[model samples]
Target: MKKLLKVLSILIFISAAAFTIQFYFNKTHPKIQVELKDNALSCNLKYSGLEGSVDFTKDEKNNYYIAYKDRIQVIGKNGKSCDIMKDPVLDIHSIDYSKDNLYYSSGDKIYRYNLKQGKNTVLLKNIPNYGDYKDSLLRINGDCIYISIGSATNSAVVGDDNKWVKENFYAHDVTPEDITLGGINFGKYRRGAFQSYNTRSLKGQIVPKHFPGNASVITYDINNGNSETFAWGIRNINGMDFTSTNKLICSVGGMENRGSRPVVGDTDYIYEIKKGIWYGWPDYSGGDPVISPKFKSVKGSPLQFVLDNHPSTNPPAPLYQHKNVGTLGSIAVDSSGNLKSKDCIFFYDNSDNMIYSSRGAGSPLAEIELGKNSIISSMKICDESLMILDEKEGYLYSIKRGKVNAGTEIGRNIYLYLLLTVILSIILILKNQNS
Candidate 1:
């Protein structure tokens, strides 16, 4: 009986020892936490107030020039500020400068101001009426411009009076002229004329024209006095830039009326624009099919439509996607060559009020938060500094990269030390027990 009891005690001890060893191994495996370099510079928003879109240019002397809605401001390397344009301009969408002059866009007009003479000239006018809405301009090389025209109405079904119209009205099959049957505005409206579709054509026979409020990119010519459609079917595209490879890139908004809780994870995209390519609007957004009953597939089945006629063998997806994040204004490239090997695209997120850097080869990278300030318009690289346009306060902010904070490094080191300590404690406990 004494020998049997001894054997039982040995077995119990071994089981406990084995459990301790396994726990220590799991605890000691190091976990890596991501850290970002802190932004060095901060903003002083006292000078300008409630500004709109902005653009930056460097003079021959390498001084920075910023054009804001209602004013043209210039900042020197020494942080000196000047009111370059004494008079105000309206809806200044974008600005670009050459060695001797500055060019800007306001609504449907493009203007050039001579720096030497301080005189402004209307280079192009009456390009197109945006129609009870203001448009944003993007410059494409020289003598060409891109503009985004957004949809005018909120989301609603064709012939329905609800706010926010879906992009694919054909799937709904109710022409813009068709009247709603049971809604609040029922029995008093015509067939098919939904809020987004043009009232002039509702037979479903004509190619749908551009949505009055849907965002579109228009290419305008200054030398030849002509303009053409560069791309269309965008829903309020605010951020636009070009990649290092000269591909036109844009950040667009997602479907607005899908749900009241802001449609979590509906998928907003960053697209590389190609000529004559229609991003699925009214039918799809973010590679997902928007279903409606109007289009025929099979009886008593949901009608589905895709961007392409057939399942795309090679559809271009977003270089990056931010679910439920609202992107405002424009993206800035690191033109100073500081991050030559990294992705050149730096976009500001309006939803989180952050600045995110994309890895050049189309990989998901880390996002850096820009504190609490809201940047509404654009960003420009000046020398080694990043100048952000703050639309609400009408100021240009200069931001620089600085040393990694001591707290961040210390936190990482402590985490490592804790894991090591836990492992050593377990080993010591086992050794004592064995003795």
Candidate 2:
């Protein structure tokens, strides 16, 4: 009996210790984060006014290249600005400055513009423009180019009030089973309008169709010009990145302005893209099952017409939830020595106009405020600070640590740590006695 009691004591001790550690992490993280957030240094910026929807890329020589409207502009450190476009490229969304070429994505294709040769080659074509979300979010990995494409319809259903439904109403006959993301959990996602259409155009009577070559993210090979789907079912992953381990992580936008859905409190998400996993769009939001208005006992179109017929499985939860962040611009994993770890992700919300640094669940955030109504279009880490582009304000600003704010995060953190430790220790002691 004594031996059994001792064994139980040991087991309880270990389990309680583990639980307490996790509890401490969950508790102390936010408190420390609040302190750090409160004491966060205001943005220190070297401002340069730019024009249009400016996208930036830095070359090896540390020169800043900006693509806007109809030209490619290069701004030198000595305050000289020059246009470098051989031809005016309309609607320049993304640009990458490599040693051999200047790669840019516009319209329905990616162009590899050879600098010395002065030639343009079509790397990938037939890309989908799903409403306005098809901005061709682009980035250059080692030997390839990655781009994100959004869905074709709102909430993957033809609602009575949607504008797209009124226009392309005949194009889609979609169900949940059409998603087919090729994973363990296939039943969770309702594929959108882009996934429903057979082609960009309709030939005969429009029925439900799967748009060919329509994927969320695609990789373009520079050598042979072959492109492949990196992942799918991201809904509208506006901004994405290849991490240090080359794994894709992206920021997904929530559905808003849909005639049938709620708009104001919609939640956006940032996720690490595990290939073939669906990040619950149209069917789910903010790790919770999206309650379609039609699914309610309303005896209406959404309920009586669609919900009973849909067969999609459950969708996956997000890495982090950003409440009220409607349109996310760009996501960069910060390696700068700012907070605790280097893998923390810093993402900008164009709608919110704030830069948030987070590492999934139970991690602290270091938020830097920008001016109100300022749209933080894109960001890049340079010299341990963020080179932020406020496209609406037409200014390139720098955000970095100045002086550590008034109260100390360190001293309070230590006190809380000890307090939690003592509380847990006392609880464990009581538990042992009862056992």
Candidate 3:
């Protein structure tokens, strides 16, 4: 009986020791599979407290000029910093550098700042406001600047307009044709006092006979002072980049309100934009047309049509599904111009409050979780490393690709093996004592 009890105790001890050793190893092991390079450039957050969007431009000298809100900050190669312009007239949103000057935009006005003289010249002004213009995500493609304009309203207009019309007098079941075009026009009334307030509210209220909302891609010519809509029907796209195939890829946001529901499962889209092509907005989201009792529609209404309504005419699907992950901020392409584990798009996931990398091809590769206080505003590829801007701290973080440190990995493995051996020895001694 005594011998049997000793054997039982030894077996129990071995099992417990093995579990403990395994648990400790699991906790310490680095889960990241890809290696990161050691010698990489990193930047500390030099400035803070700027509202609005920010962008960076690199000069031939390799100096980085950062444009934020209303100022331009130049960071020297030696990590020295200087604000070239202070209390500037324009509210700068995006900036780019040419050979001798820096170009930026405030509203529809584009300005060029001479790096040597610090003089500001308006390159273009009073560029038409087409409701959904987001200056920060503006792109200077070839000879023109491409800006996205989103819809002005939550959804398409619906219902009758007579203020005096008794609620009961209006038949709840009005025919679709009777109310389709003559709904209550909310146009500029929704556009309140402030410009941002007006834009975020008013622009998409009335459906223009030709272009629905003023939402469009306005292309501005830097050499010739002319601008026009390159494409239309985008609700509120924040990210745009060109693929290796030279196809203009954009991340398009979805409609705000559908029926009485406030954006439940609307799927945002990534489109390979073609000239003059209209992506369905205010009409459909994620191949599903929005239906509302308030709005009347004709037979060919996007809502009335099913996914199979026009098999060949389906709206482009999103490369990935972020059902309610909130807004997708920026997208970058890899060397091959494809989105893969290496060629991935890094986006700020507001839902998870983290930076997630989707390898434009397969599953998500990695995630860098941030604290509650940290908010990532923008991301850019700087040489071999990836730089992310933390808006809250005004800090820039650089990430590089390299192998796991040999010393660190080997040390971890040694510790794990030693722990396992010690546990096994303890069990063996217990067993021998029982025998």
Cα lDDT of candidate 1 equals: 0.52
lDDT per residue for candidate 1 within 140-204, as digits (tens), equals 55566666655333222333433233543333221111122221111223222233332322322
- Work out candidate 1's RMSD over C-alphas: 15.2
Compared with the true structure, the alpha-carbon lDDT of candidate 3 equals 0.53
Query: What digit string (tens of lDDT, one per residue) describes model 3 on residues 1-435?
Result: 676566567667766776776566455432322222223322223334433437766777879877778788888888778889876556666677775778777765777789889798886664433232335356666677776655433343321231212432321111111112212223333321112221222323332233212445667677786766676655666667665455666766765433221344465556667776655554556555555443344332233321122212455555775545246666555535222344466666655566666655666544566556666666666565566666655555555555435644654576566577667766766776866
TM-scores for all predictions: 0.61, 0.67, 0.62
- Per-residue alpha-carbon lDDT of model 2 for 1-435, expressed as tens digits? 665566567656765766666567445332221112435443443445674755787776666788786677777776677877746656678888677688887877778777678687777776765353557878887878777777655555434444554555454323212432211111124322323322231222223323323326777777677776666556677676655677677888876645333333466788777655545555565545545441332122232112222233566667887765566768777654453256678887666456678777675354765667577667776666667776776777655567532333443355566566667756765666687
TM-score of 3: 0.62
Displacement of residue 62 (Cα, Å) in model 3 is 1.6
Better of 1 and 2 by lDDT: 2
TM-score for candidate 1: 0.61
lDDT of 1 at 9: 62
Top-down TM-score ranking: 2, 3, 1
In model 1, the runs with Cα more than 4 Å from the true position are: 1-55, 76-80, 86-89, 126-133, 140-143, 154-201, 207-214, 222-225, 258-265, 292-315, 335-337, 360-363, 392-435
